[model samples]
Target chain A: MSDEAIKKENLSEEVNIREAGGGGWLYSDVVKDHFFNPRNFMRYGEEEKFEFNAMGRVGSPACGDEMVLWLKIEPETEKIKECRWRTFGCGSAIASTSVLSEMITEKDGMKIEDALKIKPQDIIARLGGLPDRKIHCSVLGDKALQAAINDYFRKTGKHERVLTAGAKVIDSVLNITDKDIEEAVLEGAKTIEDLQKKLKIGALGKDSLPAAEELLKFYLEKYFKS
Target chain B: MLPKPKKIREIYFDHAATAYTDERVVKAMLPYYSKTYGNPSSLHRAGREANAAVNDSRRKIAQILHALPENIIFVGGGTASDNLAIYGMARAHEQRGKHIITIPIEHHAILHPLEDLEKQGWKITKVKVNEEGFVSPEEIYKSIRPDTVLISVMYTNNEIGVIEPIADIGRVILKYRKEHNTPYPYFHTDACQAAGYLSLDVEKLHVDFLTLNGSKIYGPKGIGALYIRRGIKIKPMILGGGQERNLNAGTENVPGIVGLAKALEIAQNEKEKENKKMRKLSLYLWKKIQEKIQNIKLNGPEIGDDRLSSNLNITFMDIEGESLLLYLDEYGIMCSTGSACTSESLEPSHVLRALGMPYEYAHGSLRFSLGRRNTKQDVDYLMKYLPVIVEQLREMSPVRMEKQKHARYK
Candidate 1:
């Protein structure tokens, strides 16, 4: 949400803070439109209707957000034939992923590479904008799409493409692994600072920091059984 | 040819947040704002009229609370009254004692000030409430110290609506004061939520100070009163002109004061009948929701005099609260949630946490506070859609998936 959107929503008397999911003018009009009426949402018990070639799942419902994206790819054009998603999150998360789904499979379809290239900023632009706190929600949509594209590549025996793309790569200098992240978390490295202090995370590149943080959270969630 | 239909009438269940200003109250205030507008400090006829209105409101509220008119000091809403009572009393009596005692379930208005005092080298002790959301007077008594200068507890909790044993706690405070021959520890109760449904006779409750707000009782916002027992001294929070007997220093809010008095009068007059009707509606809605929905848990005490007649907080398992709130909003129903996502701080209700509720339940809790305007028909409308909303959100929950996975392993 921009300053102008905030001012506009505040100026409007009809916007109920409770009705906006307690976001209180934190969402853009576009975001609200997509959230209240999400396009290509995989409704409950309807996943069986779509024969998708790839599936991606991320986040945990216990932490109050999760997304599952299923994509059907056209083999002839190597484009996404359809994209549908199921999400359990706030309005921003729903809207970001909703627009992402629509953007990817609109008209004929977006190519696999083009869909993978779509970033959180692209989703935010399409949805007008999200609040600063809700920018994290936009990241979920892009991450899920990456996972879906990875799934598609692996399923089609395109092993080289799968390996070359956004697969979780081990940090060259820190040598951070899923197991290493789990061990650090169990050894009381629960925060990003703790990871950096104990395991020297980001010793190699800043790109590995997000991956380490993600794995740390994943393992922490598992450790706490949440 | 047929015409399209209009939308259903919206139902508001967030009365605990703030009620619609009564039309009667508004009518009474209009003259003060336009015709009788005057600074009470001015020595003109208009000023006299405004001062008379303020005095009349003070007398009206004092009579309702069974307190002397002179002891009623008007200020800005509940938060202001709370600040005046806690910060004023604590600062005034700090020389006698630097310790304060309160419950963990108190509103932030009380809790946050005590915390600030603690930072300034005051000892603060917090008594915990039980899982049923009741604070035992004995627990507060146990926490009381010789240096404890104030004990501020809310009369009725705004979120859970559990009525604390305030009079009993007051008796304990009075007994301790009498035995010690010291007025070091003064008892206060924030009765903003209780002003409508509960008796607030200061003498009967044995409280040194009591806080009441107008907005929660269909009165105008930005006006409230604190009942200060005669002969009790407290420092003023605001410093300026000698208004509000020098306790609250500002030009009087004549319109708001008049509106508050009228609103309180109407609330007191109709409290009994309103409570009876609302209690029945609340219980009916509770039973209907329980019967219609699975995995539902009530968050507050059992419905009765002990609980506010209008408050019903419940949690739905396997679903988050924000989603339920949004869905209900689309259906023209308004309510609040205890979920962290719903709050600016991203922290769930401290009252629920004090009750020892699990994180999942705390994250899923929804608060429905009924009011004088609500009816069984409105509740019927709620029930018609709530079950479906809960079911849809539950189906989308990942917790359900985890449960299925666990069952498969079994």
Candidate 2:
């Protein structure tokens, strides 16, 4: 056989094994598309070129991921004219942020309130679905968007209109809040056992057990269909 | 400017993950599967033929390691060999002590088993590694105790490809044994990665137990052997028939044994030439990457005698490793990463973390392990797309710190 034919045969054999063993492309085609051709990403050294009134950043470098978002808003209309972001995260994080940018700025712009209402589930759904371990990445985009909107509100002297994303305490004794439960759900807490393993939500006081369990179920239903 | 990037065949650069089976080894194994297929335990002509194949294979491997054939025990795979050596030796020597000395940069196959041993009342002292992922013999010597039962250190790290000072560490153990007038603490080295490139002379290394994997050396998967020193008692982990001198009990894998022996012979014979070629290619790959990509930190030892010739791990600042890996996969260039997102447990590589690498740098790490099939053309092809991919990912990344800031951590 020719060298090229032998190479093709070998390639097919390896590819077959990889696909059969679930080592092929990890994400959906949508996720791959968004990751490869991310929209509205602030190119390196081009932060100054984009006109933006408000900026927000989230995640810590120590946590292995961080995201910074830049937003240009139409003041009179209270609409986001442009959304650009940069993320130091995995493919899911990049895809989520890319799709979020498109969601907010597609067909001109989205109202600031509407953009804030776009949940992590929406971003994940638009990308087909992220891996269970990677669902936390989608939430980062949502939180960063809220952070930017709050920044816009603070800058515009609309202090009362500014919203706190996760301040409602769900477990009073442990100071664990609904946000903690929501995050646990996004991080693959499918059952109460998984939730307890992650957060130890009601370990301190029995009083918050029912509440924590209730919130866990609510977040589970909100994120996962089950 | 550049001609439209031509569609290239897949470049298998993840040899450190696993290697393609060599045709010669397969050819050697074919006859054992069909013609000489028999239970080695059975008293028949076919059984005797199968048994002879196993013995001959063991002899070939023993010759390479400069060990006796009777000392080698065939096991399932690399992890099985490690598990057997650790649990078997530890269980047998429990009366001596429960203490074990190891380094933090060992593969999960070793570390996880050690963790299990720790839960079973065994004391494990993990010696720290230097910034370049080197565990000093002095530190290991200091960690050794009267109660220390085993010293398990890998011959070469699978991730960063850092070659440990196993012989020096072995000599330290030997000196301790001599001074204490006791053979309580036995030394073991997992030479799965080193079998293809380095020496496996058990006497020169002064190791009591050495692990070798078949798949890592272009042999069949699901086959490995552990070389135990003569007269060093180790309890069998698997219990059934009287096989492998009653140290391991299972149906003998005649084909796998033959293939492993054949692959090891070929690897040993071609070791020097292949190492020279890979060393030159790896150094060239690193140089080209440095020239093309900015703010990239080379993980582990410099590409020389201290590091495996086929391995090159780099941390491209600002971009997450999983994202970079995926982009490279698009170009049909296969590699692996130590990034948290790529790992199932969502924790960054324990090996990189043990090296005191910051979380961001650890998440950005990528390992490109070259192999026999790789050439300068593969490296050139990688260079053609790697810079563009890194630039794109960096543009999308939010962490915009100067490399000098992270250099302090290094």
Candidate 3:
């Protein structure tokens, strides 16, 4: 069959490309667009070329995804003049960060405060929705943006405005923090035994055990609604 | 207004996922579906004709595998064949023993059934593979216990295409069975990936049970077979009227069976010629990719006799596999990735993990499995876009290989 005829048939039939014979297109058109031609991404070895004051990094390579956001903020209006990012992640992750960079810097750039308020849902909606399992990919951009905004606040000497999500140290002996515990809970650790298996939290003594258990309960309830 | 879709030429390189049905196989199966459509169990003339076709196909498959026709039992697919071999044998022989041995890099079809068996108080020992994804026969021999009932391994790994020493492991099992004077541990090999490329003679391999899938051999999907050595008792997983020696009881898939037989015949006849062509093309592609792309690591055994001629799995450092896969798809080049982001559980491929590959490298791996339809021109087209896509992704990636690793690539 002719290429054009096959394309026409595919479009008319509306065959879900993913279900077709040989691993056809898997993402939405918008995702394809962004993934193919990403917006506001720093070119390779050109991170220093774009003069950005504050930077935030989230996720980890061990987790199979990591993202870094570089933002140039205008001091006077607290506006993000430019937002560039790089990610070691999947197609959904690349698309999420690409769209996020546009949303933050488009239309003469959004205010840093407004950018911080943008949730993963807004990013997913803008990108025509990611797969259910890929919702976590969207969250990387939101978390990285908050981290960058916090960096900006710290840079501007607005110490009180620096909102910590879960960075505070909860266990002094193991140097385990609330953020570590929260991540453990999010990673499917329900009971204190599971958390202990992962983080070895309360290793030193029984004194910190109660506090760790309390924090684990709070995180479980916060994330799982249990 | 919607943009007009561009006419992009497609280049398929994911045959490891599944292959397109061969036209010859399709033609062979058409008559069974329409003209000779009859339940083989029926006593009528039409049913007898259908039964004859099934028997002929069974004889052809048996001749190829060097096994008797009665040893071949057809099932739904590769997974079904694997489930039958593992679950059927384990359940039937549970009174003898409850321990099983397998390599960690087995396909989920084998691993999941073993996991289910584990919940039933069965002990599963997953012998580790080396860095090149080669399972050691010595380790398999050491892992065997008096109570071990089955030892399952794949002829060739699907993800990295590393060819295990199945015949060697088979020899070890034979020695153990003779020395112990007990037919306690029966050897099984999942040869779905090896059917089209490697030898399937059951006598040479010394396997009690072997699995073959139709889809992997360019036949119809949802059809596969398990070769059970005669006199080895196995409980049936699917219960119904007597069919497939009362082991797999269901209406036979005559068309699929016919197609599978034809496909296997063609595959065996053309195996040497296709392997030579595929080896040359795979080497050409890998050499060009290595020369063009930087910071890449070959995952499996250096593409040669130790690996399938059609397989090339490479990890492009600092870039995730799924992003590269999608970018390649934009140009109508299809492939697969071992990246966690592509899977439902958000974990990298268990095969890569079993190779002692770190999470970073595992997530960056991509598999290119060539097939009968692919050619040198197709590899050229892939090369044209692959380097560009890798470079693009690397630019947008925050991770960088250490200087030592980068120097090794250089």
What is the lDDT of every predicted structure here? Answer: 0.79, 0.84, 0.85
lDDT for B255 (candidate 1):
95
Q: Which is superior by TM-score, 1 or 3?
A: 3
TM-score, prediction 2: 0.89
Give me the chain B TM-score of candidate 2. 0.98
Best by TM-score: 2
Candidate 1 whole-model C-alpha lDDT, 0 to 1: 0.79
Instruction: Return the lDDT, model 1, position B88.
Output: 90
Compared with the true structure, what per-residue lDDT tens digits does model 1 show for residues A12-113?
A: 222333344435545667777876667887767777788999998866543456788899998889898898887776667777888998899888999988
Q: What is the lDDT of residue B120 in candidate 2?
A: 94
Residue B338 in model 1: shift from native, Å? 1.9
Off by over 4 Å in 1: A1-26, A47-54, A73-79, A137-139, A149-226, B1-6, B401-410
lDDT of 2 by residue, B381-401 (tens): 989989988887877887876
Which CAPRI tier for candidate 2?
medium
* CAPRI quality of model 1: incorrect
Alpha carbon deviation, residue A45, candidate 3 (Å)? 5.1
Q: Per-residue lDDT for B1-410 in model 3, tens only?
A: 11223566799999999999999999999999889999999999889999999999999999999999999999999999999999999989999989999999999999999999999999999999988899899999999998999999999999999999999999999999999998868999999999989999999999999999999999999999999999999999999987999999999999999999999999999999989999999999999998999888899888889999999999998899888887787677899999887876677899988877777788899999999999898888788778877887888999987837434332
Pairs that clash in candidate 2: none
Descending-TM-score candidate ranking: 2, 3, 1
Error of 1 at B374 (Å): 1.4
